[model samples]
Each structure stands twice: as structure tokens, then as C-alpha cells.
Target: MTTIKASCPSCGDVELTPHQVRLVVCSVKSWSYYAFICTTCHEEVRKPAGRDVVALLISGGVVAEPWNVPAEVLEEHEGPTLNYDDVLDFALWLEQADLLAAAAAAQGPRPRAQAPETAA
Candidate 1:
């Protein structure tokens, strides 16, 4: 069996093992799928990817997208996920992306909400 080591970011322990598959079932949804989880810690490693798939794309570290992306397009462009070092890189990239997104949003759409005009 192939093994990889990772430090547990949550507990500051160097006991995390290489990727392993875990099946999760939600109470509300019966759909189940295997996810890569930390071997030692057992925390779903895919949590970050699921939470912010778009941000991961902007950060250029959409790790989980490759396996999940359709096969036909895989030959053209493949998305590799972040390793430990890649996580650091992702942070910097996301920071820049967030700034750009914010700037664009500020310059573009503005919502207008007005209460009904009250009679004097």
C-alpha cells in the first residue's frame, strides 16, 4: 500500500497518513460517495474542496476537481490539487483572487433596495 505523511493542521501533529477513501452518508440525502480522508485523523480532506470549489479554481488548486471532472475533457486540461506546500501557494493565490473579485464586484453590480414612500 502506498503511504504519504502529512501534518495534522487541526492538532499540530505529524501523524496524518496518505489519502484514504471514506464513504459519507448525510441524514438528509441518501447519495453516498467516497472521499479522501486523512488516515490518522480521519477528517475529510475533501472538505475544503467541497466548501469552495470556485475559490479553489481561482487559486489554481482545484485538487478534487480532476477526479470529479468529466473524462472527455481530462485530456485537454487537468486540475491538480494542492499538496502541503501547494496549500501555502493556494493561500497567496486566493488572497489575490479575492481582491480581484472584490474589485470587480465593487465596480460592477450594486443592489438597490428602497422602502415604500411613507405619506407625510
Candidate 2:
């Protein structure tokens, strides 16, 4: 069978079959890329490929590898926007301890003031 020839940046053009090239598709990119170890220099080479190149590579029998991007990228932020004052408040709160106790210490334990008895 006739073998396809590919040129390696590190090494000159070498004879290899289509299956020898590795094609990777990343979800974040509209294009795909390929990596192949040069038979001449034994070094790996990677290059980006457009749709046409991708089709050609697949048609030529290159192995396909797929990768997915993180789902958090699509998630929306519904919480309130933070400002400098808000950040300062949060930092101060973090530095404090026993919030309930601090509140109680500030206000001595005392029964709620009762309304004066109303005369009929």
C-alpha cells in the first residue's frame, strides 16, 4: 500500500500512513489540531487544522481525539455585585469571632421593655 507523506518541522518530510497522525478536537475552539511523532527525529509535532484540513485528515484515516471544556464557563452569576465597601465589611466580619456573644456583651442581658399598663 502507498503511504502518505507528512513533513515534520523538526525533521524533513517522512513517509507515514494516515493513522499515524493524532487529531484532537477541543470544545472551546472552532478548529482542531494534530500531533504526531516524527519517524525521522522521534520528536512530537503539533499544528492547528481548519475544517477542511480536519475533514481531509479524517478521510485519510487519522485517529480522532476529543476534549471537553469546563461547564462552569456557561454558568451565570445571579448574586449581587460586590463593591469595595462590601469587601471591607466581609473582611471585618471574618476577623470578628462569636458574633452572638459580642452582641450580647454589647447589650447586657435584659428583658424586652414592657409597655406601661394602659388604663381603661
Point to the candidate with the largest TM-score: 2
Off by over 4 Å in 1: 1-82, 110-120
lDDT, candidate 1, 13-117, per-residue tens: 333222343333332232323345554666655433232333333243222222333456446655885589988998999999999999998898877999899
Per-residue lDDT value at 55 in model 1: 39
Please, what are the lDDT tens digits per residue for candidate 2 over residues 27-117?
Answer: 8666578878899889998889777777777777776788786799767889889999999998888767567678879998788899999
Displacement of residue 60 (Cα, Å) in model 1 is 52
The C-alpha stretches of model 2 lying farther than 4 A from their native spots are 72-120
Best by lDDT: 2
